[model samples]
Target: MIKENVNYKTLDLHQRDEWLHFVMKCETYDVFYLPQYVQMYEERGEGKAQLFVYERRAEEFVIYPFLKREIRGAAEGEVYYDITTSYGYGGPLYSLSRLKNDDDFVREFRAEFERYCKAEGIVSEFIRFHPYLETEAGLASYVNVTSVGELIYNDVTKTEEEIWSEVAPSKKRRIKKSKRNQVEVIFIDGKDIGPKEILIFYDIYTETMDKKQASSFYYFSLDFFQAYFTALKEYITLAFAMHEGRVISANLLLKSEGAVTIHLSASFKAYLHLCPNCNLRYECILWAKRNGYHIVDHGGGKEKDDSLYKYKQQFSNTQTNFHIGKKIHNQSIYNKLAKQKSKLVQGEQADFFPEYRQVLVTPRILSNK
Candidate 1:
């Protein structure tokens, strides 16, 4: 005996808000994913948000709110099935805790949702079943599970002097040397760059992507730039490292809560001699000091211990570990296949990382700092 309310479109927003608010209060709840975000996503003519819920009789349907979008026309901000996708801490926001039909409910919920996804052909990739969410059993049906790290700094408010002091002695020397070489570090926002100034940032970004042998989720998305600046300009910014008038390095940062999310970044190889990456990061940290943000999530890149991690760690000086979980559309099948493959070689899982997989390309992909 199960019941469900899947018609997000039919339900008035207040009802949805009430449901989401309750879910938001759950012990595992993260901040609301910004309701207007989903509206904005639809207004963009990119896709739609749908909800499919199953409630057991006597056991009320306790909705764990998730954002959803069809796979064919999915957009960047539009992820399907998020209990707390954007908030960086949205998994099972609340628990039924002790429902009599717990096991029966899980089965019904999974079956109905799987049928919904198949009928709708929703896009699991965009859903971003963050690596942290994989531990939840029910989520497996709606997402693709994989490993993703927050690439966060341990401390966001360490003093400037502290930032420098924490650097490996080797990196310390490099920064001192870069400043000596006459490299200029600029901290700016989108307004800092005239439209004409954009291409310069693109070239540097392309170079870094090429060197890393990887492509970010967003490469040259002007639309996303417009959305970011228009919707989140207050909390978003960019950092650029320049040598003379030429752009050599850049990093895009999103200011949220009390810290900055280092969304994306790139630099030139020839300029590696100057450590423009390190210098630009330092500038952003200082800017964050006066402006208000205190933390930085550089995001996961390559195998750890490379020059990139070292550069970010120099300023971060701390590590706050979090995983990016993913749930593919079909888990039972995939798990069975994975275990089969592992029997021959002990394979763990498959995912978008190791290749630096990303999905959003903001105009600020270049730096304003």
Candidate 2:
């Protein structure tokens, strides 16, 4: 039980740590969607980008996991997770385990949020919001949930050896034989590398994007990578599969909370026939397991039962399918806009960037662990 009285001051590192620890125990602990990443994004922000925190005064100051966003609608402010680090709909990171005894906590938390929102002249908006609120704490006026879509994770722990052994023979053979193909998979600690490789990654990336009839959400300038390189480097693994001094495949993954997130993966078209893409991912799983990670997420497969669904199903130790849910804060406004916008997005077939529908390319990398 903590209480404080305060106004207007962003969380210093010391305060941020104490605040999160309090929230973590309150039954709404989600590592990925926490405010810390939002803070990270803010520290890295430039130009017009903004980051906001919901704070309350009590025994210990409380902060919520929302970041400041600039958007257009009825409102100028929205709560967001770090779009880059946030894989799926980050929503509000709340622990359902605290529902009953957290009455005082919730009342206090909401009071702080409302007071802050009012003080800052901010309004709530969600292009896609947390589905957990509906399942765990239910919903209210301050919270408006939306369906950005779902993200998937594979559970490998329950998978039996025979299931693994049954993978398509040709695929397995490719994995087995790729070892002789004169390729080097090197893991680099984030430092000691220049931006030369980032462009290489995009080149190999665009090749696959073309094959899939998709486009990119944002083509980052080298400067963008340079900007966050130091802070992000600590938590990320940059893996490249090289051949004859030429880089053929690469994966930009994040290792946090014992979880490895696959952010970007790509390989040259020349190597596709060799199944280097699959081999690269297989090696990732091995690294994940050996490092004591609980799961390696290959992520969502589109078309509900697309070809990828078949491919990743082979390695699934288990499947985590998030449900798509929504809550409209304003029903009339939503009903008016949903139809035309929905049609526009469905036309683009963009799965990764839910905010806009553009053709999306799903790249595959193959290699053995």
Candidate 3:
């Protein structure tokens, strides 16, 4: 149990320095937890980004960053909000190495967090837990945790040969075929990315999106991509697959402390047979290894073992479960909101949590990372 002396702190966007400093102190954290990353979403009117820190002792704490969005039409003249993690994976990042095993500390953190939420009019929270970090397990005892899917990642800490040896035979053939077809892969530092490169990526990415008939949420504006390249330049890489000197595919790699995530990727449909993406994936693993990154996260698909997930599995046999945490702080208010939503919409998806937000036109939050 936590003592009365223990305290918590909330940092807003204005406190970038303090927010980053706290995140840096964590034993492990993803780029999703960074202030600059969250600020992009905030600029897009996603919500007001806030960082919550619970301190057990000096250099021992749990830091959770989320966007607090106002719940519209939940009540009359009563403003209620719900918190959600950004598009990518994130949750409470613990500083103490042994914190995961300490049940009492997690329970206390939950109790305190619930109190804070109620006091702040935060009716609920939704967390997309980190797959590699496994941060969800720590809160499973206190929160509702559900295994959403499995993600594939390469253990780049291993030697290049070892990593290659683990690649699925069919994937190896496709990568080899790509090489034979002269599918050249190149890496561009995000700092070096400019208007021309952005346009090339935008054209190719949007083409793929259109082909897939992806939702509006997947179609990020060119300005958004520009801002992304600028804000996260130091930790970003643009990898492109070229055939006959034409850009055939492109991927955005996000580098964290020790892992590199394949953030967004797309390929020209005409070059699909050339297997440009396969070559791109293999080359990315090599690039990450050469650059000292320890892992390559090829995030999961919309559903478990879906086509996209199967495609990523070819790169690495290693897999990790992606879990999400859901919590409701104010049951009465939550029920009221759900009831209101039910009246507003004909059929609300029973599975969509915070049930109030299930309007017909509201885009379902799809996992992009």
Identify the leading candidate in terms of TM-score. Answer: 3
Backbone atom clashes (below 3 Å) for every candidate: 37, 24, 0
Point out the worst 10-residue segment of candidate 1 by lDDT.
347-356
Report the number of backbone clashes for model 2. 24
Query: Which candidate wins on lDDT?
Result: 3
lDDT of 3 by residue, 118-213 (tens): 778998888889888888877766778888788899999999899999889999999999999988999999889998999999999988887777
Q: Which structure is stronger by lDDT: 2 or 3?
A: 3
Estimate the overall C-alpha local distance difference test score of candidate 1: 0.50
Clashing pairs in 3: none
Between candidates 1 and 3, name the one with more favorable lDDT.
3
TM-score of each: 0.59, 0.65, 0.91
Worst 10 residues of 3 by lDDT: 341-350
Candidate 2 lands at a TM-score of 0.65
**lDDT tens digits, residue span 46-99, model 2:** 112222333333333333344454323532354322112233344433434444
Candidates 1 and 3, the one with greater TM-score: 3
Q: For candidate 1, lDDT tens digit of each residue in 46-85? A: 4443233444443344343344533322335543321223
